[model samples]
Target: MVKSYHPETLEEALKILVETHCIPYAGGTDLMVRYRQGPGLVPNFDRPVMFIGHFPELTAISEKNGEFSIGACVPYRDIIRHPHTPEILRQACSLIGAPAIQNLGTMGGNICNASPAGDTLPPLSVLDATLTLRSVSGERKVSFLSFFTGPGKSILRDDELLTCIHFRLPHFTVEGYRKVGTRKANALSKIAFAGFMLKEKDMLSDVRIALGAVAPTIVRSRELENRLIGQPVAELAELMPDLLKSYGKLIQPITDQRSDANYRKTVSLRLIKNFVLKEES
Candidate 1:
């Protein structure tokens, strides 16, 4: 039998989190599958389960102070459809799954779960997103890049819960997102890439590239990004091989059921080059 609590206010919820030592449940899309399956199927759940689905504080998404505040419980479908959300996030969310998963899964749940293949994460990483983690005592902010510690782990503490994700809108950001799947929708990414590049007056002023399923964590190709900076994007198509070389050095892929290391690396570079070419044109 599972124990549940519905705390109306965040303070009440935090208090309950402390007192009951419960593993907070958000959408339960991931947790429910595990709870029913058995021990090896899911991570061990020593604590009781606390439901935060209906918590009023975790459901707000609005703009403030030149940045957007995305509530932890806000579903991917809503984020994709919201007029105020950045296009990169919306585009990523659209490819996360069909309507069913998007309607039920959430940005916070995705981040907190820390899945390397999480569709929304690479986009958020390129967007320079930050997470707000809160507890009864206080709140702290952490960058999206630093938040994910490993494949299925995060910097989040036991007593802390993710409150909101925040990001500043880029002035000349071109959003590019692509996923490699067996089919178009509702397929796990063999490898996925999201990028934001700025090319004004034919000069590559800036670029951010992030890849999922190519590494233990979502990786930002800083070396490739630096080499691409200040170059004429019109000429970048010729530099694709060198860029791929740098990216290949940075990413550590693995042979898994979904795909192999070499294939993952090849496509990772190809996708970035493709997106860069498209953005420049």
Candidate 2:
């Protein structure tokens, strides 16, 4: 039988995490599905489980010093409804799943799960979020961009608990998120894109683009973005084809059950093109 621990406080949770090296359980939406035997049944566990979803410290959302700090256990529904939540993130959260799932699922869980197709990842990537990880020893911050090593993988240690995710507030002329999936809701993305741009007198100054479900992890290219920044908005349409071609070379999608590589590639570029055009208008 698997042992279970429920800690009321984050400090207690970190102690449990370091001492027992148990699996952190928050929301358990993905974990349960991965361990499920069948319908109307609980997942069988082979290791100790630490339930940390309801800890008060991990459920708050606050803003300070031009940064928005969201607790690891803040549910998707809460983020979607929170007045201070970034619009791009709120939009992503609103599309995650059905209402019940949204109410139970969390941003930290989503980040820790590290699914390449995770709905929230692209937006987080574009936002340049950072994660605060706490262990009995101390706390450390990890850039969201470098957190994921591959699909369903992250640099998080067994003794560490992700406490919060935060990012500087973005100022963009236009921001967009697009996810191509089988259905509008309750479906995994085939190809997803999130983009934001800062324009000064019709010249792009800051441009960020993040693509999901197209690689081992969420993909962002500073090199490619540099090529577009400081360029006139009027030149964007003429430059799009080459940009898409360059992105196509970098994004190596596979033929998975959810989607084929060709389709994912085609749709990914189309979405990028549409995003640029929308910003141009």
Best by TM-score: 2
TM-scores of the models, in the order given = 0.92, 0.96
Model 2 misplaced regions, further than 4 Å? none
Q: Estimate the lDDT of model 2.
A: 0.89
TM-score of 1: 0.92
Model 1, span 1-281: residue lDDT tens: 45668777888889998888898878877777655656556545666788776666677788876788888988887888788888778888888778888888888898898989888888889889999999988999999999999988999988899988999976554667788877878888888888888888889899898998889899896767898899997798898887777778878888888888888888887887788787542
Give lDDT tens digits, candidate 2, residues 99-119: 989989998989999999998
What are the runs in model 1 whose C-alpha is more than 4 Å off?
A: 38-45, 279-281
What local lDDT does model 2 show for residue 46?
73
Candidate 1 at residue 213, lDDT? 81
Deviation of model 2 at 251, angstroms: 1.3
Clashing pairs in 1: none
